[model samples]
Target: MKTKKFQGIVQVQYEQARQSIQTGDLLFCSGTYLISELIKKASNSFMSHVAFLFEWNGRVLVFESVESAGVRIIPLSHYVTNYNNTGRKYKGALYLARHETLIDSSFDRTLLQNMIGKAIGSLNRNYDQTELIRILTRISLGVGRHKENEAYICSEFVDQCFRQIGIRFPRTEAGFVYPEHIAADPHVYPMFEIVP
Candidate 1:
């Protein structure tokens, strides 16, 4: 019952958040897990996770890589409906942004879906622990690169999609590209900021 009520209270906020996102837009989140704290420390940014939104047959889905699930596509409802890991719902803290330079027309729908398909297909793969550590280390010293691995970290997965069209993210040589880095670009416009 407690979980049900908690879900009810946050459901409205989730809906509001969903409305703010559009197809081809990017979403950044401030998570409550302990690792989130470390990610914030490593990246020196508020956001710990990022995902892109996709509208399919009237349902909004978010594609992201998570430590628990690696690279996967989830419905927007599943992404935001539940209370955060800390069991608290904060308002206006999470945000979604779109790159001003990212025009939807530049992408071929079939090719993009194929890319997403590749991610969906890679579900059997695991999250890249080595890459995660490399990201943290590189973020601190601003040097070194993660060796190629089959696993997926959130930022690397998202960045790969954008890289498909020849868009260089973060405009940096940093070893690990971060979610905050993507959302920080002047070209990325904030779509919604809800204060609950």
Candidate 2:
């Protein structure tokens, strides 16, 4: 249970037992502003259509709009287009905008904790423990990397393969640092962090 501190505000450290976290455990983390940059980057593409789709039981689900600004998920149908392209030009095309329900600090930590709890709870029913942990890790690392100050946000989409199966969440010192810790600086904005 050794914990590491970051940004003088938030600190999260995983247990050594978690090092071997199987492909069935769930990892949950959250942040803000990263999703906006993703949309901005996607808009630059010449003929790319990005949409977020939640898949369950072989069916595809697309998000209409993200609660927060600048985050979107690309539809799977877009991948069917130009199937002959082998370079995976469509890879990493979709994005998830960070969603923040709070505008100010009026809500207590319980509210924030509950938000995360609900997300995890929802995920648990849909996926196995390992898959749950992998997705959470993917998002945590994705958000951790883009923490900065310019008000610009970026979206980091976890691959569908990784989403369905289980992947390891990196257990590095840098991986544990929260986005808000680094985002405190005004000059260091619009970046991405990958854990693992």
Candidate 3:
């Protein structure tokens, strides 16, 4: 892996992942911190910063920004390969499980709406709800109809994230249902309408 500079950001560029130090760059760093004091300070402050966990040179690195608008880029190869290349085996499993356990054809709009609400509520405790929703919405839109398993995996991962943050999520229903009215009633449940 080579550490390169992109637009004045210190970046570690690898075949699978890339890192950069730039303004507005959020890094979801994983692993133990060497300087606990600095980590504490950064964690307490930098609320507007974007950070995420990424691997570099086969090791995980904490990519942080000293300024705003800086982004640390990590190619998906660092985490997992493209689902298309794997014949969607992993994706299929995720979808079947979600469809069987979390969502099914018999589910009403209210249940789906409730699931979304619970998902959002769980995320709100740790990150900004608006931002999380934006991210999730983008992901959902990109998923389309063909990637059912991918969507299911994403939903399940989100639920797990909520749990990790000590947020309790409502039990999601099985199967998909329509009659959008259930989502329209604000008093009934919070709905995250996916826009096409």
**The best candidate in terms of TM-score:** 1
Clashing pairs in 1: 91-196, 92-194, 92-195
lDDT of 3 by residue, 1-65 (tens): 01011112322333322322211112222213332223224323111121223334655432222
The candidate 3 region of ten consecutive residues with least summed lDDT is: 90-99
TM-score of 2: 0.21
Order of the predicted models by lDDT, top scorer first: 1, 2, 3
lDDT of 1 at 91: 27
Candidate of highest lDDT: 1
Instruction: Please report how far candidate 3 places residue 117 from its true position, in Å.
Output: 1.4
Q: Using TM-score as the measure, name the better of candidate 2 and candidate 3.
A: 2
Better TM-score candidate (1, 3): 1
| Winner of 2 and 3 under lDDT | 2
Model 2, 1-196: lDDT tens digits are 1112211232222222223222211122232235334322322211112222344354333322232332333333433332124533233222222212122245243443332332333331221223223334555454322222212111112222122222222222423222232222132222121121
Q: How many residue pairs clash per model?
A: 3, 24, 21
Instruction: Please give, for residues 62-119, the per-residue lDDT of candidate 1 as tens digits.
Output: 7888888777777766544443343345322456667665555655555556556655
Superposed model 3: Cα runs more than 4 Å off: 1-96, 99-103, 124-196
Candidate 2 stretches with Cα past 4 Å from truth are 1-53, 56-70, 82-168, 176-196
Each prediction's RMSD to truth: 7.4, 17.3, 20.3
